[model samples]
Target: MAAASLNVENVTGLLQDCLSKLGFEVYPLKVGWYNSVLSPSLRLPFPDDSLAVVVLSTPAMFEQAFLPFMEQRGCQGLSDPIDQCVKHCATSAVSQCFPGQNVDVRYDYELLPSRKPKFLAQTAAHVSGAAFYYQQSDVTDQPWAEKKMFGVCVHPRFGGWFAIRALLVFEDVVVGSEVVQPVPPDCVPTREGRIQLLESFNFHWQDWSYRNIICPVQTYSQKQRDYFSARPAERFALLRTWGFLPKEDHQPDISSDAQSEMITHG
Candidate 1:
């Protein structure tokens, strides 16, 4: 939550730490490698409850992310269109467990309006299959600036390809709630809440400073708000209804070569 954009290293480390504390041994399994057919109905090594949490960042849906390639290798991490990772993840979760093993998977999915279905499925899967999943929406809705800001750490010239910040939250009472700080008049609720949570969370930047943070700018208009508000619980219910281990259509036309080229070139 600390201004540093989410990355694989940070996410894995955080989950490892969290799981270790929760008395669960974390095992890093290649989702694609284990599931050769990309279908959830398959034999897996670990028991259902063995997997305490599955941290997914939803990086696959990004047109330029390495996710599509991951899926192409027979992994359910990503499939055609990329927005169905959560759906597939749910399938994997249900399939990985025993007949009635109560295992849950958690995802730190990136928040994207275009990938709302993925986001919704993540939540709904947890509700339906009884898995634990969480998504971190982008700081702002603006595309260009968010891309640039996130690209900074991913850029080679910045002398930094990535950074991660870790924070600790003690289960104690919060202080000085009576004297809350003033908020902007036109400030949006989601953005304000994100900023507030970021500030409250204690995180350490792996290789970047928080001061030079280039946060994502909001782009949601009145119409967008109306749409989101209107269908707030839509994705959750929709995904839950999809159920676990549902049938999937193989889209042979969609190739991973395009994604590989994009992530490598830009």
Candidate 2:
């Protein structure tokens, strides 16, 4: 049994479907902001010292930023231009993953310049993509700090909303007699199947320290399509404050059965 933690959005159902079909019990992480910060030593997210096979995915931004760039550059892709930008945004996150070690600078193309393009391409693709997936970095400063505080300000002309991909798979799992039920087989109920599992997980910025943030999976399932259809008011509000152009379609979709109600923001 393997487990990997990542910040993705709405993947529990997909995980439940795949793991259950394979006959592996898949219990997801239960989150409570205060739980970790209030008691760092408490094994609140998962079982203590649990060792399992881990499979982690990365954010789409990481994917978009790194993948195509690697393909264009030679085998030693990291030495290429994109790594410079990735490192700029990824400094804090990379440090969290590799604390004592220096940044792994050996781009394959650079190291094996004599290698053929096809062979080098495969190697660089694997390494660069793998680094994005597993290399944990803390975005506690600089650009991340700004984005987190002001939300993701992509473009002045077309600022977008920030959607969070929550991270699961923690160090703790079982809590007393409460064995969190594994994701059921029939429960793989989303459009993206097991692959969608990764897509469902992402980190949304919540300023509410007043209450512990929790992933509302049931709501996600009930309103899956609606959630992704268009931007929410809150998102637009943030963008407006950031001085971005207003959304073209300000009207909410009245047709959606989910008919998204206004959420109370603290």
Candidate 3:
């Protein structure tokens, strides 16, 4: 496709048409919006006005895309099953939508030689107006003091039940001044509400109460929650018992750092 043919609307529309029914959401943002939030060293190596799209998975993805993917293509080697499913869906959509385009695709689980993520998932989601990323700084009066509290993204509709999956950069597609950045909705706007959110996320994440801060319209199904709650090794065992993963597949369990780097809320 010609560069002139690609704009934020068509690019995201193509991705949405492909991924939305499979339970994914696509949001478009300029490279500058993402780069402007981070320091120089963390900036993406793209023209400021380059078109980029962020992909997110909602609760329906488990039933809509993942199970079907597993049924058709089962588990392959030791990689995370969810990661494999997401890559399959995202890459296929990109290739099918724009056959010859130069797209710089980055996944949430990928890391640079510097051990940094290819792109900050939450930041991308926030800038793309997919979800509101609430960090410790977003809270006032400093409740944690010396202790550090990690940040989390809350989708207006899905709350924390969604995950930012991938970022697609259209290298040759640049948008003019007409495109404007949209601010992510501030769901947990109150100081007390923000406090509860951070505490639930940092200290009691296992309970998943943080995800309910905004009273999401939908949440993960019981089966989906069960899958995410298990440890990575345990997840493999569960899949095998369910006749999805083959028994002979001895993909070694991922490390703690990788666990922390998962594309999931796990």
1-266: candidate 2 lDDT, tens digit per residue: 22233222223344434333321222233333113323454323334422111112122332343333334432232122323423333333334433443322222123233342211211111121211111112222222222322111111111111111112233322222352323212222232331222222223323221111222221222122232333343333333343332445253333323221211100
**Per-residue lDDT of 55-83 in model 3, one digit per residue for the tens?**
99999999999989988999887888899
> Candidate 1: lDDT of 227?
23
TM-scores of the candidates in the order shown? 0.21, 0.18, 0.96
Model 2: lowest-lDDT 10 consecutive positions: 150-159
lDDT of each: 0.28, 0.26, 0.88
Better of 1 and 2 by TM-score: 1
Q: Which stretches of candidate 3 lie over 4 Å from their true place?
A: 256-266
TM-score computed on alpha carbons, candidate 1:
0.21
What are the root-mean-square deviations of the candidates from the true structure over C-alphas?
Answer: 18.9, 21.5, 1.5
TM-score of 2: 0.18
